[model samples]
Target chain A: MNVIEARHLWKEYGDNVVLENVSLAVKAGEFITVVGTSGCGKTTFLKLLLGVETATRGDLLLDGKPLPDEPNADRGIVFQRYSVFPHLNVLENVMLGAELAASPFWGRTFGKRRRAIREQAVAMLESVGLGTALLKYPSELSGGMQQRLALAQALIKKPRILLLDEPFGALDPGIRADMHQLILSIWRQTGLTIFMITHDLKEGFYLGTRLWVFDKRRHDPQAPNRFGATITYDIPLGHTDRTTLHTIQQSLGANHD
Target chain B: MKRLINQRPSRAAQVLLGILPFALLLLAYLWASELRLAANPNDKLLPAFSSIGEAIWSMAFEADKRSGNYLLWVDTLASLQRLGLGVLLSALMGLVIGVANGAVPLFRAGLSPLVMALSLIPPMAILPVLFIVFGLGEVSKVALITIGIAPFLIRDMQQRVLELPEEQLIKAQTLGASSWQLILRVILPQVLPRLLDAVRLSLGSAWLFLIAAEAIAATEGLGYRIFLVRRYLSMDVILPYVLWITLLAFLTDYLLRVLTRRSFPWYYNGGKP
Candidate 1:
């Protein structure tokens, strides 16, 4: 069964439309990445999925239930700009989710609950290669490390699903590639489902099992007709092997047809 | 980053720096005894640094024959009582009002302008009005300090709390942190350092106001002592008292800086943004 399913999802901003008639589904533990140009409403889609924003119309389902209106520990999010709390040390940032997430037994308890969860945070940080840097502040670290911390913050809670909004889009090419690989490794180890949004097709091809493309029709008649904002294609997990990669590369060289 | 340029020198260096100016003054005062002997070195008028120290050692510290140790003790107790009451009342009232105004949009819009105006008007300017309402009693001085300082603390608390990042708030709420939990764990921790600074700032300002406060219609206070000496044209007493006040202010500011550093180390060391 699909872990996440959306039917005729519509997101509108005043008069302009961001995403319309966007429907998609993902199997459990699938690594899906949504790719599009700058204004493609990809970020909006991720926000909607993470419950940071609401859909204008249509139904959003999470494991067959109605989408929650706000964020939940069941789904963790990482943003392009690192969301690592600048005031909290790495360990605290990671454990904060669990402490505040309200486990049945941990409720009505404070410091005692955190002590146990802190060990979990350290192990998770160790998994992310941040064992030595767990006490360091985000400002003291480099950008790539901060992203790693953000990833660690999201992962430590052991959320069943993770949502990333261009987590590597802001990094340099080398770091971005490293982050992509690290994310893949973590997903494999933790078996957490991921849905990432990015504009880089190469990244989408490399890391994503499933991919969606957003396009917007231009207002200028003189220019090629394309979406100013809309999703154009949604491709499957096995859709991108060597030949499909070549096809996307060739298609890029040929120009928008 | 690039070596912080010793913004705060070591404690020894600070002590050395503080004493150096006095040393120079002492040398000058002693040198004047040779050829430039200012006619009368103990001229109750100019009370040199050494004389002021001697005078302070005589008056503020000396036994009060009339009030029996009672004069000094009573002044100290009275000042402490007024200060403690005013600060406590202001902190409690300030945090509540500040949090309310900061958190609520309508209240912030409607009342912030008034708070801003209150903060701008000098408390000394209206000292006479306060005296008229509360009279020259302990109530007048404490009330004056409370109203005079609470707005700034309230505004500081309000702005700092309000400025807490929306992303963190949303993150906490998503984690199921109730409103009270959010304030205790998230908002208060973030706002506290700034709140402490505001309190200290208001306290120092109130200390200055205290002297002006006690200068009128009262029998005893640090300020009253200073005012009484001024009436007698006794620079010996006035000079020493002024030095005491200066030293007190310096020590208080230093203590506050150290306390803040110790309490809110998170503030000094960068943490989760």
Candidate 2:
């Protein structure tokens, strides 16, 4: 079944149409990475999927139903920055989703239940290689560690779909590669649907089972925003290996630049 | 990251750097007092340090014959009570009004402009109005301080709440946080440090209002004593009271800074809100 389906989605802010006629049917457990030029509405598409913003027109469905009007547990997202709660430590950050889901209004659950949640959070942190830093604040973590915390914070909620908007865009190349591997492994283990947007052509090709390119095919100088970006290219990477796709796309993307 | 170039001063130098100006000012005052005393056997304007010390000792230790209370301690307690009550009330009101103004458009539309106008009105200008409404008692004084400071605090808190990154709020909602849950767990914790910082910033104005109200009308308070001594040209008492107020304000600010650093280390260290 398609976990997320967008049919002729349209988003506009005032006169600026961001995404127009964008359509997709994303299956469960698929790693879909999107690459686009800056201001090509890639992030806007993610926001639509995350339901932070409603579409100006068209329909987006999650599980073949209308997309949620606002953000909900069905979808989780990690931004490039400020994703984790800085007030909470590593463990508390991961545990917040459960706590909010359970005893959201007041004091946290006590006794065995609280301990059980803590253990679960610790295990989640351990899986993200952040078990040792459970007591540390987000500020104390390095750039890489903080992003890992962001991942753990999102993953702990067990959302059906995870949306990432350039989660590792700020990291160095080495750390970004490591995060790429970590995310791929998590996707494999959990069989979770993943949608990510990146400016790096190579990273996009290396990770996703399918690739989407968003761009405006026609631009009018008199009315530059007359056409919004759409999924101009949707390529399935089932047979192409990462290296081969990267090499070919590197040249193609270089030209598209 | 670029290496931090400047080296910290040695411990001894740091201490000396802090004390040198204060020591110089004290020496200057002592020298001026000596010249005055030589010119006149008893000059009330700049009484000898010993005379100020003696006045403090008497007021602090000796019971007043009329009131049967140690005037200095009584004044300190009264002043502290008024200041504490006013500030506490302002903080609570600010949190509520500010959060509402920030999080709810209806609340913001109804209250924000009015708050801005109230903040612009000089707090001292409303002293008579407060006195007329609440009468010449502790209520009037506390009300004066609260009204004088609360508006500013509210605006500070409102701006802080509004400035919170949009991503954090969205992320919380996605985690299945209800609107109230998002506020209590996410917004409140982040805005708390900013609240304390605002209180620290507003302390000066709070003290200003407290003293203005007390000086105008009060039976016993630090400001009352200072103003009362002015009639008899008792600089000895007045100087000591002024120093005491400064010391109290400094200590409060220092304590708040330490508390913010200790309890919300991420706030200062991360520089995020």
Candidate 3:
């Protein structure tokens, strides 16, 4: 059964259409990676899935029901930067999701419940290689460590779906490689569905079970807003040949440069 | 050859440079006072340092003949109380209104213009109205400080709240935070240090309003005492009082800085809002 399905989803800000007729269905644990040129509504589509944004004119369903218009614990997101709360130390940041979920009124837990959340948070942090930095604040961490903390913070709620918006875009190459391994292992262990947006085509191919390219199918020079981006190519990975990869890379390289 | 900007002074040199101007000013005052006192046996304009010291000693240690109260301590206590209450109330109101205005569009549309208008009005101009409405008492003096600084605090906090990254809010929501939870857990912790900063920035104006209100109506306060002695041309008492108020203001600012550093170490280490 599909965990998420969008039926002709449309999102427009007045005359400026962002995503038009975007429709897709994702099985429960598919790893979908999206790549597009800047301003091509890749992030907007992710926001729609995360429920921070609503489809302007169509249905976005989760588990066969219309997705909530606001974010909830069923889905979690990580941004490229400012994903970790600067005020919270690493352990508190990871514990915050469960704290809010368990105690909605005060956003806190006490004694035994608090102890359990702490242990859970510690385990999550350890999984993300942040166990040693539990007491350190976000500002004290390097960019890579902060992203690890962000992932731990988001995953503590055990969301079925994780949304990552260029979460490793700012990392050094060596650090990003390590992060890619960490994320892949976590995904394999938990069977969590993931939708990641990346600017790097190579990263998309390496990480995703399926890849999507968002591009404008039609253009009007005089009325630029008249046309919106749609999924130009949806390719299943694992069996994709090098010639196809080269063609897609050549087509996207011009815009990227 | 080093550029001017690159030629920073050594530690000792920096300390020397800092004291130079103050030393010069003190010498100038002493010279002028000596000349005035030599020409006239009793010059009221600038008293000798010894006279000022004596005034401080008496006001601080000796009780008043009629009221039997140490005027300096009484005045300090009264002024501190009013300042504390005014600032506390302003901080509370500013945090609530500013967060609401920044986070909720409806609140922003309704209250932002009124806050802006309140901020623009010269607070002193409304002194008469405050005195009339609240009466000539402690309430009026406290209200003056609150009215004088609260709008500015609110506006500053609102801007700080607005300056927070949009991703943080969305990230908090995805973590299953309600709107109230978002404000309490996410927004409030971040805004708190900025609020402290805003309060520190507004302290100068807060002091100005406090003195103005006390001068106009109060019987006992730093401002009241200074103005009361002005009629007699009592430069000794007045100068000491002014110095004392300056010292108090400096100490308050220093304490707040220490508090921010101790409580929210992340604020200083992180990027500016």
Scored by lDDT, the top model is 3
Candidate 3: tens digits of C-alpha lDDT, residues A138-226:
88899999999999988888887999999999999999999999999989988999999999988998788999998878878788889
Best model per DockQ: 3
- The local lDDT score (0 to 100) that residue B198 gets in candidate 3 is 90
Which stretches of candidate 3 lie above 4 Å from their native place? A253-257, B271-273
Clashes of each: 16, 0, 0
In candidate 2 the C-alpha lDDT for residue A67 amounts to: 87
State which candidate, 1 or 2, has the greater lDDT. Answer: 2
Model 1, docking class: acceptable
Model 1 over residues A1-257: C-alpha lDDT tens digits? 88899898988877667877777777898998887666668888888887878999898898999888888777777777637666677777777777766544333335777677888889888888889988876777777887888888777666767888788877888888788889989988888889888778878876877877766544444643332355555677655577766765564444343
State candidate 2's TM-score.
Answer: 0.94
Off by over 4 Å in 2: A241-257, B1-11
Report residue B228 deviation for candidate 3 (angstroms).
Answer: 1.1
Q: Give the Å shift of residue A124 in candidate 2.
A: 1.4
* Ten-residue stretch with the least lDDT total in model 1 chain B: B33-42
Better of 1 and 3 by TM-score: 3
**Model 2 clashes, total count:** 0
